[model samples]
Target: MNQLKVELIVDNRVNRSTLSGNGIRNAVSLQPVLYVGGIPNNNHINLTGSGLNAYGFQGCLSSFIVDGRLLDYQRALVLN
Candidate 1:
């Protein structure tokens, strides 16, 4: 299975020795949403970047746990 892991730790300061070999982007990011891609909405053509690209997530999210708590993305989507 092709897998990729991205761990973001929000901390003040910690021992760097404990850090793993994972791709650790040490500096905090200003734009939280690093990657952005979506289908164009013809209805809202006035909106900027509406017809950008179609590269949104395309796979089943088996699991998404944050702080040891499993999140309900499907339910959230329906609510919104």
Candidate 2:
């Protein structure tokens, strides 16, 4: 099986607000689901999403799992 590394660039303040927000309130603004799919190579893979902004999120990617299995991964961004 191959592992996929997911990256998320979320607003730190918004994420914190959401974490602290009760069910009635929403923290950061809701973003569309981000999907990255591609062949795996080396230790990293390039990803693209439909709704992703040109300026990616600064926060770390969390809750990442591949095929129901969890693994440690990192992101190295290449700006174009």
Candidate 3:
């Protein structure tokens, strides 16, 4: 089975605002869908390490949904 990985990097703050907004509400900001024609005997699709926030949310404000799943998390960022 062939497998593929997809990663989406975005600004947590901006993405969260967009999601909360009335417009563009029911759409996945990152990796909406995949179109593949024909059928494969053995094929595997994996969603790993996606929707990564480029810069960690600097406060308790920012969220997003992936595949109809909502994830809310906010904390201070420590850089080394």
Q: Per-residue lDDT for 7-64 in model 1, tens only?
A: 5333433222222222333211223323323434542212222222334655455555
How do these models rank on TM-score, best leading? 1, 2, 3
Question: What RMSD does each model have against the real structure?
Answer: 13.5, 14.3, 15.2
Query: In candidate 1, what residue range of length 10 has the lowest lDDT sum?
Result: 21-30
Sort the candidates on lDDT, descending order: 1, 3, 2
Error of 1 at 11 (Å): 28
How well does each candidate superpose onto the true structure, as a TM-score?
Answer: 0.28, 0.21, 0.20
Number of the top lDDT candidate: 1
Over all chains combined, what TM-score does candidate 2 have? Answer: 0.21
Deviation (Å) of 2 in candidate 2: 23
lDDT of 2 by residue, 8-57 (tens): 33443332111221221111222322234422244232223222223433
lDDT of 1 at 77: 69
Instruction: Give the local distance difference test score of model 3.
Output: 0.33
**Model 3 lowest lDDT segment of ten:** 17-26
Stretches of candidate 1 off by over 4 Å are 1-5, 8-55
Model 1, residue 5: what's the lDDT?
Answer: 39
